[model samples]
Structure formats: C-alpha cells, structure tokens
Target: MLRDKIINAISEVGFDEYKEISSADIIFADAVFASCKANTCGNYGQNHSCPPLSGDMDTNKQRFLNYDHAIILNKIMFLGEYYEKMESSMTEVFELLDRLRDQLDDEPVMIAGPGGCNLCDECSAKTSEVCRFPDQKRYSMEGSGMDIVTMSRGLGMTYNAGDNKVGFFMMVLY
Candidate 1:
C-alpha cells in the first residue's frame, strides 16, 4: 500500500521518469565516475549538508531502511560538458526536488542526490557549522558512501557514464 501510494505521488510529478523500488537501489553518480568523490567536491566539507559534515552511508541507510518504500526520480540533462552539465543538471535536480518536497505536505522523507549540494549559495560545510536549511538541503549519494554503479546494477538500471552524463536521485519515505 505504501509503495502504491508513493508510485501514485510520483506519477503526479510528471517527471521525465519515475519508479518505485521494492528496496532502494541507490548509487552515487560520482561512484560511477572514476574521478569523482565527496572530497572532490569543492563544497564537500564546506557545506553543512555535504560530506565531511553530513552523516555517512551506513547511517543514511539505517534511516532509509526505516521506510517501507522508495521512489527514484530522474531527469535526463543533455548539457554539453562535465562542468557545465553539473551546474545546469544539479540546478534542475534541486528544482525538481523542491517541487517534490512541496508536494509531500505531511510525508517524512529523505533524498540522496548526485554531486555537491548547492542548496545554498554558500554552505556552512567550511565553517564546521550547523545547516541553515535542514528542511531544504539534502546530501548527494556519493557524498555519503554509496557505490552507485553497484547500486544501479542491483536496480537493473544500466548507468551510462560519459563526458556528458545524466545525473539522478532516490528519495526514501517511511
């Protein structure tokens, strides 16, 4: 029932694509790319919500497993290159995430995304401070400890890695 409910909510999103996972098969996008890592993100320790600050994957998983179902929401960004695509695609991802968050008025949910979190222009990850927008910001999958390529395979989703790759996310709700 929870799974069906989440699927219904996702359908209302009109996203490029959305699916309900029996159990989350999440993977961080950077894990699929050899050159990427949490520290690799300039905002890594600089943002309260990103790595070097946010909790690790084991903790993240404990939280996620509490949920009965998860919904994977994705968009295909056809940007020109790596740097440019990260900017545009991530922006779109946050926008979509914001919309999704707005739609879930009473549902308690957690989302894990692609690369660095730009939820705020300047994150407190640098100052070793608390997050200003605990309700709005989320940690990227790789920023934690998920090996996305492996997770993708578990989900039966083939990750296509390239100079112009498509970024994605997974939101788990209890």
Candidate 2:
C-alpha cells in the first residue's frame, strides 16, 4: 500500500519512471561529493545546497543513513538536435518531487533533485547571506554526496535510457 501510494504520487506529479528501493540500497560515497568541485557545475559555492555550502561529506553520509526508504524517480526527455533540454528535464523531476512530497506529507521527506535549487530565479547565495526559500530548496543527489550511476547499478536500474534521451533522476528520501 505504501509503495502504491508512492507510485501514485509519482504519477500524480506527471512522472512515469520510478522505482521504490530501500535507502540502504543506495551507495553513498564521500568521493562522489568530492567530485562536485572537480566537475565544477558552477553552483559550487553559489548555493547553500551545493558543495562547500552543502556541508561536510561525513555529515551528509550520516544524514543519508538516517533515512529508511526512498523512491528513485526519473524523467526521460529527447532534446531537439542536442541535449540542451536539461533544464526542462530537471524541472520535470523537481515538479514530480514536489508533488510526491506533498502526497507524503505525513512523513519526513527529503528530495534530492537533478541540480541546484530552483526555488528562485537567482539564488540568494549570490547577493544575500541567507537562502530565500530555505524550506523549499532541494539539493541535488550528486550534491548530497550520492553517486547516482553507481547507486542505480546497484539497484539494477539503467542510467542511460538511450541516445538523444537524457534521463534525470531524483530521490524522495523518507
């Protein structure tokens, strides 16, 4: 019943690709968190939800272990001519996570989305000392220190659906 509720939440939010898995099934590594700096997503020190600002890797790992279940949700999209539709794909995941969070409000829910928090057009980190929407800000799974590819593989899920089709994933940790 719980799984169905979660699936329904995903569907209600306009997402179709998702799988429920134990939180334990996910692989959390400090090395993955470290990659944020190397990858240089540009959100590094610009948002409170990203690396350096997201906090220490050890704290992130321990925080993840405090959860028991999560629904790994994804959105597959075909960008026109190029994979430039990433923002669209990421927004889809964000919406789905928002709906899922609303549906499961009875529980403590944490959503690790595709990229930096989109609650604001311009993050307050750029001009202010505090976040504008701290409560709504969702951190990326990668930013949260989880290697999605490895975690997906461990859970027997395919990261790449196909060429031209970019897949964006988010975790509804509860």
Candidate 3:
C-alpha cells in the first residue's frame, strides 16, 4: 500500500518508528499551542520556521488541513546526562527528515520537524532578514499549533521513551 511505501521510505532514511494516520485523525490546531512557543520557547521570532515567521496560527492550521494523510516519523537517541546534546540531536533528526522527504515522490509534501529550522548555524531572522533556506527550512509541529503529546497518545505512539532518552517527531503530510 502507499502507506507502507512511505513507511519503507522513512526506514530507508533511518527512522525506525513511524505511523501512517489519516489527516482526519490528527488533533485540530489550537492557537493556545502557538502561545506556548512564543511565551517560553524563545524561538518565536528567531527562526523562520517558528511562530510569527512560520505564519499565523489560523493559516498554518488551514495549510495542515489541506493534506489528506500524514506519516509521523520518530527517532530515539541518547540526550546525554543533562541534555547537553540536544542541539546536535535535533539537527541530526531533521537531517534524517530531509532525507525522508527526498525519498517521497508524492507531490505537495509538507514536513513538520521536531524543532525550529536549524538549517543555518544562526537564523537570518535574527538579523532582520528573511529565511535564507526557505526550501529547506522545516517548521516544528508545535510551531504550527500541534499538540504533539496528545497527538502521539491518540496515535498509540509513546511520547516519552524514558529518562535520558529523547524522541524526535516529524510529520510528512501529503
């Protein structure tokens, strides 16, 4: 089936855990979710893939709803004793996501990665400039108002793997 093909592609790209879910099964976007990013995450205006830069909450939600299906991809990695390796881990996960996207021949695929766009060492948004890698930049699922924890639970996926174990989530929508 097509879902199996997508899952195979994900595995080829090095993601071992994934689920194919109808877009209808996804939890609806909520503006309050976006507020969490701006209020606490501190990447609100720092990255093109984040809020205020990604798009308005309503627009992001509508864009997401336009897709009929999605593949939720995940990777489990050691987060170190105190999460010092977070940045490197996030970048690696997104690189795997990029490879997964390349394997999909389907048109109109949108990928919402685990964190803000880390395409560059420093975001151009910090310099008051537009994104330098618009084609490569990845928005976070949360940045688009997704409640990933709830979504994962709804999909029968484990959100928290364990202590010192970090799980990255990305969605390939088409």
Candidate 4:
C-alpha cells in the first residue's frame, strides 16, 4: 500500500521517468564524494544538507542503505540552443521536486535531490547557525556521493534527453 501511495504521489508530481530499486542497488562512489570537495556548485560546506555538513561519505551511504526501497525520479528539460536556460531549467526541476516533497510530506520518506536543500532562501549554515528546518532539510544525491549518472544509465533512465535537453534526478527512499 505504501509503495502504491508513493507511486501515485510521484505520478501526481509528473516526473518524466521513474524506476523502483532496492536501496542496496543504489551506487555510491568515492569519486563523487571527491567532486563535492571541489565545490563547483558552491554548497560543499555552505549547506547543511551538503557535504561536510551532511556528514561523511560513510554516513550518507549508511543513511540510504537503512531504507528498504527507493524510487528514482527524473525530469527532463530543454536548454536553449546555447544552453542559456540552464538556471531556469534547474529552477523548474527544483519546483517539481518541492511539489513531490509536499505531496509526500506526511509519509515517512527521505528525499535526495539534484542540489543542496533550498527550503530556506539562505541556509543558516551560511551564518554558522543551526539548520532552521532540520526535519525538512533536503539531501542531495550527488552531494551524498551517489553516482547518479551511472545509476541512471544502469536503470535505463534518461540522464541526457538530447536536443539540448538534460535530466535532473531525485530519489525518494522509504
């Protein structure tokens, strides 16, 4: 019943593609963790849901593994010819992820999305303060060291949609 409920919620959120998998099947790699330290997205130590603040790789891995099942969801969006719509496209995906989060808010689930938590416009971590919403803090898939690209390929999900389109992924573990 819970799985059915989750599927319905995901459908309502209108993700482009989804796959159900055992939590154990989720992939984690040290290289992904290493990438976080590069701080290309600039959330490495700046967000509570991100690395250093979220915890070590081992901790993040164990957190996902503690769950029995996971649903990987993705939404594909088209960038402009020159990839100029990157920001807006990312915003749309985050909004979709937020809707999914709201739809399943009452359920016991852990959501890991494309980037750091955006619940607060400016994370309290930036001010060296405690997280304002610990319970609602969103985790990041790549930030947590999950090799999303590889996982997506293995699941036959779309990481690239061609024609200047790309997929943003998220996961709900329960």
Candidate 5:
C-alpha cells in the first residue's frame, strides 16, 4: 500500500521515468565517494548533505540500507546546443523534487536527489553551525556515494536522452 501511495505521489509530481528497486540493490562505491572528495560540485565540505559533513561512506550506505524499498525517479530536459541550459534544467528538476517531497510530506521516506540539499539558500555548514533544519535536510544521491549512472543503466533508465537532453535523477526510499 505504501508503494502504491508513493507511486501515486510520483505520478502527481510528474517525473519522466521511475523504477522500484530494493534498497539493498543500491550500489555504493568508494570511487564515487572519492569523486565527492574531488569537490567538482564544490559542496564537499560546505553542505550538511555532502561529504565530510554527511558522514563517511559507510554511514551513508547504512542509512540507505535501513530502508527496504526505493523508487528511482528521473526527469529529462532539453539543454541548449552547447548544453547551456544546465543550471535552469537542474533548478527545474529540484523544483519537481520539491513538489514530490511535499506530496509525500506525511510519509516516512528519505529522498536523495541530484546534488547538494537545496532546502536552504545557504547551508549553515558553511559557517560550521549546526544544520538549521536537520529534520528536513535532504540528501544527495551522488554525495551519498550512490553510483547513479551504473544504477540507472542497469535499470534501463535513461541517464542520457541524447540530442542535448539529459536526465536528472532522484530517489525516494521507504
């Protein structure tokens, strides 16, 4: 019943594609964690949901394992000729993720999205202060060391839409 509820919420939120998988099936790789340390996205030590602040790889893996089921969600967007609409596309995905979060507000689920948590305009972690909204804090899929590309490919979900279109992913664990 909860799965059905989640599916319905996802439908209402209008994600492009989704698949249900056992939380245990989630792939965690140290290499992915290493990438976070590289700080390509620059949230490494600056966001509570990112590495160094989100905890070590083991902790994050355990957190996901605590859940039995996960629904992977995706939204595809058309980037410009040079993929210039990236920022706006990411914002749209986050907005959709927010809508899904709100739709499932009453459910006991953990959501992991594309990048660092956007629950706040500026994360308190930047000032070394305690997270302002610990209870509502969102987690990042890649930040949590999830090998999303591999997972997506294995599930036959579209990670690359081609033609300058790309897929942004997120997951709801319950």
Candidate 6:
C-alpha cells in the first residue's frame, strides 16, 4: 500500500522523466556545499537553516549510504517567474512527499528536496532553536551538498533548459 502511494505521488507530479541512481551518479557532495558557501544565495549565514550551520556533508552522505534504496523525484516547473514559481513547485513536491509519508506503514522515509525547505515561512533554526518539524522538515539535496543535475543523470533524467527545467530531489524509503 505504501509503495502504491509512492507511485501514486510520483504520477501526480508533472515530471517529464525519471531514472534510478547508481553509485556513479553520486559525487563529492562536500564540493557542492563548498560552492554554496563560497558563492551563492542569501540564507547562508543569517538563517541557521542554511549550510555551515547544517553540519557535515560527508557525515550526512554516510548516513544516506546506510539506507537501502532512494528514489529520485525529478519535478519540473516554471523558472520563468523565478521565486513565485519556485515556491509553487516546492509546494507540489511537499504535498506529494506528505502523501508518501502518510501511506508509509513502517518504512522510514527521508526526503532531500531540490532546494531549501520553505515549509515554514521562517525557519525556527534561526534562533538556534530546535527544528519545528523533526518529523516533517526535509533538507534539500543541494543543502546536503548533493549535485542534483548529475544525480538526475544517473537516474536517466535530463536537466536541459527550455524543454524541461525542473529541480531534482531524493526520497529514500527503508
């Protein structure tokens, strides 16, 4: 039943393609984090929710390695309108993830979204406070130092502009 829900959620997404990942698809996620810190985005320091504050990437990947199997959710939406469309796209991703979360019987499902989790308008981590959603909050694959485009390639999903410009993510169930 849970697998059915996962599949159902996948179907509900407006995805152009998908592919299962192999070890080759994975890379040095640490490099991704380095890039994020070196140059990119605003939430870097001000938000405790961003990288550096998020902790070690190598450690995180090791944690992921322990998992049995992970599904790559490649969802595409409007990059034309920028932030507005980005939020809308993430909302869809979260809804589908919630569906999977609900249907899970005993399996532990961990989600790595395309970008930062905007579930809460303001992240509680800003105050050095505990995450409001220990059970629900999803960390972005990028946030965890993952290279989504390369990961998608391993999954047989392309990330070309114009034709399909969706961000990629990870959903592991064990």
Which candidate achieves the best TM-score against the true structure? 5
Error of 1 at 154 (Å): 3.0
**Against the hidden reference, what TM-scores do the models get?**
0.74, 0.84, 0.83, 0.95, 0.96, 0.74
The alpha-carbon RMSD values of the candidates against the true structure, listed in the order shown, are 3.8, 2.3, 2.5, 1.1, 1.0, 3.4
Residue pairs in clash, model 2: none
lDDT of 1 by residue, 11-91 (tens): 676555555665455443434233343356575567655554656556655656776666666666666654566666667
Question: For model 3, how does the per-residue alpha-carbon lDDT over 24-72 read when each residue is reduced to its tens digit?
Answer: 6767566545565555767787877777777887777787789899888
Q: Please report the TM-score between candidate 5 and the true structure.
A: 0.96
Q: Highest lDDT: which candidate?
A: 5
Across 1-174, the per-residue lDDT of candidate 4 in tens digits comes to 878989999988798999999999999998987888999989988999888898888899999998999999989999999999998988998988888888888888998898899999999989899999897788889888899999999989998999999999999999
lDDT (C-alpha, whole model) for all candidates: 0.60, 0.74, 0.76, 0.91, 0.92, 0.60
C-alpha lDDT of candidate 3 relative to the true structure: 0.76
Better of 1 and 3 by lDDT: 3
Candidate 3 vs 4: which has more TM-score: 4
lDDT of 5 at 17: 95
Error of 1 at 137 (Å): 4.3
Local error of candidate 1 at 20, Å?
Answer: 2.9
What candidate 4 gets wrong by more than 4 Å, as runs, is: none
- Please provide, for model 6 over 1-174, each residue's C-alpha lDDT reduced to its tens digit, 9 standing for 90 to 100: 655565665666545554444433455466687777864556564344358766687665664576655667665565554445665666776776666556553555565655566667787766677778766666666676777766666556656546335554655443
lDDT of 1 at 62: 62
Model 4, position 23, has a per-residue lDDT of 96
| Candidate 1 ranges with C-alpha deviation above 4 Å | 1-5, 24-38, 81-83, 135-137, 161-165
Better of 4 and 5 by TM-score: 5
